[model samples]
Target chain A: MPLDPSFVGRTYPPTAPYQVGREKIREFASAIGATDPAHHDPAAAQALGHPDVVAPPTFPVIVTMAASSQIIEDPALGVDYSRLVHGDQRFSYTRPVVAGDELVCTNTIEDVSTRGGHGFLTTRTDVSTVGGEPVVAVWARYVIRGEA
Target chain B: MELPAKTFQVTRADLIRYAGASGDFNPIHWSDRVATKVGLPGVIAHGMFTMALVGRAVTEWAGSPDAVVEYGVRFTRPVVVPDDDQGTEIEVTARVREVTEDGLTRLEVTATCLGDKVLSQARATIRSAR
Candidate 1:
């Protein structure tokens, strides 16, 4: 079954605000091997001139997944969760995420396509501060294996 | 603070252990048959695993888990791990890019596996713990 074209331009409600905590950022950094003192030490970060330890650039994926759930779980989209695989991911940031900033994510189904009997779903999620200040845009591609 | 570099060898067991921990069971990571059937030359490593390793490097560098604030990366190439003595490894390099007045600093990063960039154009912002 093909994806409904009407869903292509559909947008989901912005996710609830996520408070950027210093600990969470540190944990994520450690998990990925980001050791810059600025990521862990306030004095180090301050010496370098940041408000607080900044987050790694890719941290936005944490919220984009929440925002994208709206489109992925929509039955009309005809996606099979079991068959889905992460195809690609990319992020463009206007600025790095910082502690003390409340962030929100909004997801849009950018495109739907099929190839080799498989379904491809592309999503564009924008992360912004509660005041709507743009922080980053994450583009993700998911591939659903053929249902044959 | 001065940035440091680290490297790690990713083995089949490591990938399997990560699979159990991360919940990403993509067969291309652990099954040779499935990987080759899917058009890959051989079994490959998960991009997120590579990303996670980069984070490990950061954490180890910080000397504590609470120092990092943010991290991000783009998967540029696939890392294929084979079953042999010629094991595979990834080298992660980082540099302090800039610091904001609010006390956050941005670090530029890169991860290379098997002489090719598996993660590229990576960056992270971290706050000082004081």
Candidate 2:
């Protein structure tokens, strides 16, 4: 079954605010072996003009990935989780994500298409503060592989 | 213009830590049992992990921790990570494709594993640090 093209341009509601934690940023930075002092040292981050440890550029995936389930798990959308593979990912940030920021995401389905028996779904998540300050806009394209 | 290349280690431990940190508990990244069951060669590193490595290189080249304004990539191949201390190594290299007068530097990036390209069309635009 192909993805519902009508779902394109459909926007989901804002997710609950996710409070960015300093330790989480440190852990993610450590996982990627990012030895930048600003990622682990609050004092160093302060020197850089952030309130606390600033997360690495790709850190927002921690928030967008979870919030994306709102669409992938929607029964009407019929996204087969087993066949899902990340086709592409893009992030445009207004500013770096720092610790102590409460973030919210509003997901929108931008495009849906099927080619060569593979289903492609592109979704954009507008990540912003609970107060609606734009932070980063994340775009993800997922490919649903066809049966061999 | 050419930028410096960087190599990153991708061990199973790194995959596990990335899974926990990124909340992508996909068995293909951690469980060899499930990974092979699904026809993968073995447990593999997450695509996002590779992207993160590229981000690290971008920031290093830009001379700022938060210099990236736009980043994107396509996962073309998987980085197979073994269950060992020295699991695998990904070599990331990039060239300055353009430097707009507005102070944004666009980079064309390539990430390879065992000499095979793992990411395609990987690119980043950073606010160049003067």
Candidate 3:
């Protein structure tokens, strides 16, 4: 079944604030082999004018992906999780994420379409500090394969 | 100008670690059976993982972890990872597309595994370190 184009422009509520942990940033940086001191050492991050250890560029996916579950699991939308594949990703940052920050994500379904028997869903997530300062805007496009 | 290429190795162990840290427990990234069942080649690395590697290259080139202002990529191909001690390798290279007077640098990035381009329209805009 093709995605409901009517679902486009639907916006979900903001998720609960997620406390960005120092060790989580370190672990993510380590997993990607990003040895930059700013990603690991608070002192190094402070030298760079950051309040705490900084997160790697793609680290916000950890938050946004979870936040997007609201849209993916919407029974009315009827998305097939097993057939989904990542199609595209983009991030625009107002500032880098730092450990000790409490972040919240507001998810919006930007577009939904069907082409060549496949369903495409594009979502935009606005990540912000608990105080509502925008941190980054994340966009992801997921492709749902058709049963051929 | 062309930037030096950076190569990163991806082993199955690394994938497992990433899955834990990123909280994406998708079995297709670990279970070859699930990957094949989904019509994938077999146990593909998470697309976000590959993007993170490329982000590393961008930040390294910019000389700061917070240098990037915008980054985007289209996932054109899957980086299939075989279960082994030596999984696979991704090579990332970038070219300076533009340098603004205010010191923003735009880069066109390329990432490949087994000489096949895995990402297309990959680009990053960062604060110029120079």
Candidate 4:
């Protein structure tokens, strides 16, 4: 069975607030092999005029992905978790995500389709601060192999 | 959640290696002239490449790429790598935020470039092994 069309436009609840910290930033930087000081050192980040360490350009994916599970795990969506592969991803930012800000995310299903024995799902997630400060919007397409 | 802060560095060679690894040859990432033509100060790194670094961070921390059920990021700023003697550096940090009822783990994370906000806000979900 394919995904439910009714699921399109469905919006999930907002994720809990997450506080940005220095250590988490450094660990992420090192894991990605990003040897940049600004990700870990507040003094370096301060020199660059930020409240604390600033995240790299693609950091929102972390939060948004967590929020997206609402849809992926929905039995109504009929998505096969084991067969899914990332199709494409893009982000539009209202402002940079600096450390020390409390953040949350809301995920919404944008579109659903099928082609050549595969299910295609598109999702849009909004990551923001608790006070509703827009940080970034993530648009992603995922592919699920058909059960042929 | 909190952890000890750490640091890292990005050398010129790292950019070249990333270019090769990701199969993205955007001249803006390798050629100063082309980068400047596009309005960048100098060679700029690919946004996805930077994010992949973050992915590696989260995946390694989770102990498996397959564990990363979902992840995303926005390119808030350009990581400008100058033609100076010392190369630019991109840093990152991550921590476990929560564990869901079904054993899903959410990570709060951030990555930066030499103090500039390169990757503004980031997060990921790691599905624990069943």
- The C-alpha TM-scores of every prediction are 0.66, 0.98, 0.98, 0.55
For B1-130, candidate 4 gives per-residue lDDT tens digits of: 6533334455556677666544445677789987788567889766766677666676556653335555766567877876666777777787788989998888777877877767655777777753
Estimate, for each residue in B19-82, the C-alpha lDDT of model 2 and write its tens digit. Answer: 9999999999999999999899999999999999999999989988988999999999999998
Cα-lDDT of candidate 1: 0.75
Assess the local accuracy of residue B32 in candidate 2 as a C-alpha lDDT between 0 and 100.
93
Q: What would the per-residue lDDT of candidate 4 be over residues A43-111, giving only the tens digit for each residue? A: 776766677886655566666766777888888777887676556676665655677888898889999
Over 4 Å off, model 4: B1-130
Which docking category, incorrect, acceptable, medium or high, applies to candidate 1? incorrect
DockQ, Cα level, model 4: 0.07
Query: On DockQ, who's better, 2 or 4?
Result: 2
Point out the higher-scoring one by lDDT: 1 or 2: 2
**Among all candidates shown, the one with the greatest DockQ:** 3
Query: Comparing chain B with the reference, what is the TM-score for each candidate?
Result: 0.90, 0.97, 0.98, 0.85
Instruction: Please give the DockQ score of every candidate, comma-separated.
Output: 0.17, 0.90, 0.95, 0.07
When sorted by lDDT, best at the front, the candidate numbers are: 3, 2, 1, 4
User: Where does model 3 exceed 4 Å of error?
Assistant: none
Decreasing DockQ order of the candidates: 3, 2, 1, 4
Off by over 4 Å in 2: none
True contacts kept of 2: 0.86
